[model samples]
Target: MNRSSSSRAGLALIGVTSLVLAATGAPASAAPALTMTLSSTTGPGGGATIVGSVTANSVTPVPFPAGTNPTVQFQYVGTTAASSACSASAKVVSPIVVSNLLTTAGTLTVNPAAVKRISTTKIVFQVPSSPYPVNDANGNPSTVNPNGLVLMGGQTSSRWSVCVYDSDNVTTSTLLATATYTLAIKPTITSILPASSPAGGGQTITVNGTGFAATSVATTATAGGVALTNVKVAANGNSFTATTGPRAAGDGLPVVVNAPGGTVSSLDPDNNSQTNDPPIPFSYTNGISITPNQAAAGTQVTIDVIGAGFSSLTFDAGAAPIGSGAHVFLVKDAYVANSNRGVAECTGVSVIRDTELICTLDLAADQLNPANSATMPGVAIAEGAYVLTVVADGGTGAGGSANPTIVSSGATFTVGPY
Candidate 1:
């Protein structure tokens, strides 16, 4: 080959190399140049921190707002979207823009702006409410909670990961690992309805709060040490209703709830100054009783029963072992015939929560007769002083037993003819 031809070929080769270098584009750049350090990362329910410094990606370097750090962005995103386009409105955090080079550690603050919900997964900083109104989805704008990170309604996505990005940008490509902390939202109880109930503990109660889940198997509601029954959490993950179990008389008993977000106690930790009771307390009544314990053998006598712990009975639901109303009876010991120890049943007995009811004792003379009673079977109901006992009949079921009959003071009554 001639020297001139070889020179032309070398020039051609150099031209091809230049084009290839331009096409490759800075060696494919590099992953986000930021490291995140966080505390609450794995589980739900609890505050956490995010901190780190931002450096330019090896290839195309984007400056960090010139000299000021301004603010960092936080977002909840599905694992798949971590490196994909995340919306501006998805900023569930409000971290401060402390430094440009250091990017300092940030503490989480709870925004007291009424916890308005724009969506289930994010907090929107808008006009008059937050200092930075640049985070709505309409247009990619500026900082959120420009001063510090403000946490609101605990709606941290259960399936999404909490992520941090440099500056006010939540862009997928700009996802800088500023910190590795979890903002998974701890559960909180705000209020309880019908705060007081009878010591016997059979009342329906409503609990209002955030970070609760209806579908979570771990959710529970408890008062004192007894577990509340029939707990139903609302679909919104904000509240639940349950029936209280019987508890001894007390003031300000704590009602603890455990849910997917974590555990929360009704006892107000900040208000422990109340020496007598908890701020969010449940009180139990001292006792339960009935009035007008005596009645005639053939006539109806009205009786009044009163006390706390009276829960609305759901007979068909089998919610409790006892049924509605009170049953009256006299033990076999009250029978004139010693051998006839069967209990004397009352007729027309009605019962309810602290309600009024009339009872009748209509035992036939033959049934009550104690003489020659060994040969024939009959309940003994005779003229004598006796105590009337009360029982409830919710009936028994598989692997369950009926409730026990109760005897209390003011239950003494004499059976006499009118």
Candidate 2:
């Protein structure tokens, strides 16, 4: 071959190499970058409508042509795994699964049709109230492509990411751009209805709050030290109802509520002050009744009063069991006389078990009487229809001090004149 002919051939080879280099872009060129912005970062877990946009930093480097449409997807990822059969790892997270969200018939990928494109850089999307990932063709959790990364409601501080792909074939396509996001909402309790309940408890209470879960197993409510039962959350996941357990009469009994998204308590570390509005208040049952409604004055009479919220002091088995420091009185009007107060009918206030209080109504005509004067003076009264009342703590006669600890409504009775 002549030297001139060889040189021409080499120039032809160089021209062909230049053409190939021009067609396949250089490797150093940067991949397209994406910026994602959300309308809001926090909302109740049941379902929140999230509006956002993914803007490409450089349109030239995008995988698709300028006018070509691209696909986008949203996922709640606990932690990333190489395959769908995921195991626990710091970088990988278990999907937040609501009941029936990922059943045998479903898949984990959100609906591609739900993504609405307004322009090249803008799009709008709505997350369903629950049952996320509009489609999971095979509810089987074992595979890695779609359902494996789904997150359910009630999980707090979950991490979410928006992945842009060339097409809806997420199984085979590589992600063009991914933007990580956070769904941060703690469980909170705004109010509890029927704040005050009977001392015996067992009252249905309504709890209003944000991020309440319909799944009762994922939520909890308690009053005092007793656990609440029959808990049911509203469909919107904003409120719930539960029956309270037995609690003694008192003020400032803490109420605690815990949900999958967050936890709130009357005795929270942020604010420990307790009020009836937040905590559980137990009022006296006020259903006292006497064995005999009528009795003769100045005669020894034993009365049985049955009601609730009567204090019973626990004593050592060997030690003398002191009666509950309760005082009974016979007055013209329970409401009016209760304000004035009176001495107890008998000093020995014996509590039979926890419900019944037995006391000797020693209605002696005169104070000079010494019968049954073991501890207190026999009750001296005139014949008339009177109301019987029991007061805990120290009792005073006629303009006496009120016992702030415990008080009961009066029982109607007739004292026959002798």
**Per-residue C-alpha lDDT of model 2 across residues 1-418, encoded as one tens digit per residue:** 8999999999999999999999996865435445556675333332445565665554434344455444544455433222122111112212344554321112233345555656666555554333333334566433333323323443434545555555555344445545544434455666778765555456798877666654423678787666889988888777889886544456666677766544567555222345444443433243456788778876777888665556563321211112234456554554232343432254356778555667776666343211221223444566777667655543234343344223344467777864
Model 2 — TM-score against the truth?
0.42
Tens digit of per-residue lDDT, candidate 1, span 40-96: 333352332222333445542543433332233333333223332333322544443
TM-score for each of the candidates: 0.36, 0.42
Instruction: State the lDDT at 291 in candidate 1.
Output: 62
Best by lDDT: 2
Best by TM-score: 2
Query: What are the per-model C-alpha RMSD values against the true structure?
Result: 15.2, 15.8
Q: Which parts of model 2 have CA positions greater than 4 angstroms off? A: 1-185, 216-218, 229-232, 244-248, 267-325, 331-348, 353-356, 360-388, 395-404, 410-418
Worst 10 residues of 2 by lDDT: 84-93
Candidate 1, superposed: residue stretches over 4 Å from native: 1-4, 7-26, 29-147, 152-161, 164-193, 196-202, 208-220, 233-239, 245-252, 258-264, 269-278, 283-418
Which ten residues in a row are the worst by lDDT in model 1? 119-128
Write down the lDDT of every candidate, Cα atoms only: 0.47, 0.52
